[model samples]
Target: MNEIDPFKLFLELQLALPRNAPGSARATREAFSLLPALPPRPEIADLGCGQGAEAFELLRLANGRITAVDLFEPFLEKLAERAEREGVPETRLRVLRGDMNDLPFHDGEFDLIWSEGAIYLLGFEEGLRLWRRFLKPGGFAVLSELTWLTDAPSPEAAVFWEDAYPGMGSVASNGEAAARAGYRLIGRIVLPTEEWWQDYYMPMRAKLAGMRRTYGELPVFDEMEREICLFERHADEYGYVFYALRRD
Candidate 1:
């Protein structure tokens, strides 16, 4: 009787998950460990922080304060509730509703900039370039991005990403892009496949399964199913890579 809104459905499916992308506290810890030393209490910024997965991990790993920024009020709200439930003080982890593209923080404000699986909204190189100003000299930015792990992906996987993310680059290409954006590589780690299933796709599968009766016919449903299928079958061709970098 009525046309279903796709963006609405997308959020409905995504916002409830613990992680909006493939990542874990162990991954965060490993990435952080790769970085050069920082202030005893670093000032950190977590951009596009959906539900604050890495932000919470940063709480345990560093003595610094974190400013977790996300444009979606709902995601920020969930992060806030989690923070409160975990007994994290506002002073330690301040949740702010803000756009990563047009952040309000002053230049050279943070000792580290962390973004798990959310930088694609601004394109990979563009996000790294734009966020450079927010980092203090020698500060670090660790982000997880979907990267082509192989040059020859299966046709199905290639076709799917060409439509979904034409700009997706191999690990080398992204590393060069990061260099052009004024960062030197500290370290990079390909996220293990289990990270994809443990918090992201598996939970998404459960939600999508439950949503089928209501949204089955929608193209978004088909798109998500295809995505999961692609990842499951051709995982070696691509994966989320945590790139640990430092401001030049």
Candidate 2:
């Protein structure tokens, strides 16, 4: 048998049918409703959008253009296919391959900036500061980030997240960072545990199982399994918090 690239296998499995993150259409709606009613045809940017689980919902709720950007070509391809299947016009939902760290967009160009479970590619505070320039003065940015839900996390959960996200902050800390990043800390909505299991993990379990069958004991499999196991044990200790902010 030929050597299978574990990294490639990992990436392939990440396209787990529903979405690439722990988010749902309902959560997207809940987060968007927090923002003031957007102008007609509001220009939005969904940066680091993975197959656009949130973006698709946004399209259904708002009649606007969303520029969905992601680094992975496969993810972009999948998103385009989904958009096409859903009869979305190319102009309405523009897809592109790009880096989040250095995006090609004008300052004050967007009415809203959205990212879910992806901004961690850049540190939370760093991403808020960097991406704030892209939104109009009154524009809003909503992001779902992994955060410490409790001040006192169990040692097991604390050790895991500390290694995974050393800069993870509590809601209070992240809200403060949003203020420091030149935005008003508008609101927050912690994702329900159902979103984690139903939307994200349940979909991924089959993929991990497939990978395990194909390539036994790969590091990626172990890493992913560890995360799932950890979440099952300590879901209450930490979670993805949606932070809604508006540029000052």
Which predicted model would earn the best TM-score?
1
Give the per-residue lDDT digits (tens) of candidate 1, residues 1-248: 67888888888888867788888888889988888777899999999998888899998889989999998888888999989898999889999998888999899999999998888888999999999999998889999899999988989998989999898989999999999999999899999999899888989988988888866667789889889988999989999999999999
lDDT value for model 2: 0.89
Clashes of each: 0, 0
User: Any residue pairs clashing in model 2, and if so which?
Assistant: none
User: Per-candidate TM vs. native?
Assistant: 0.97, 0.96
Error of 1 at 127 (Å): 0.6
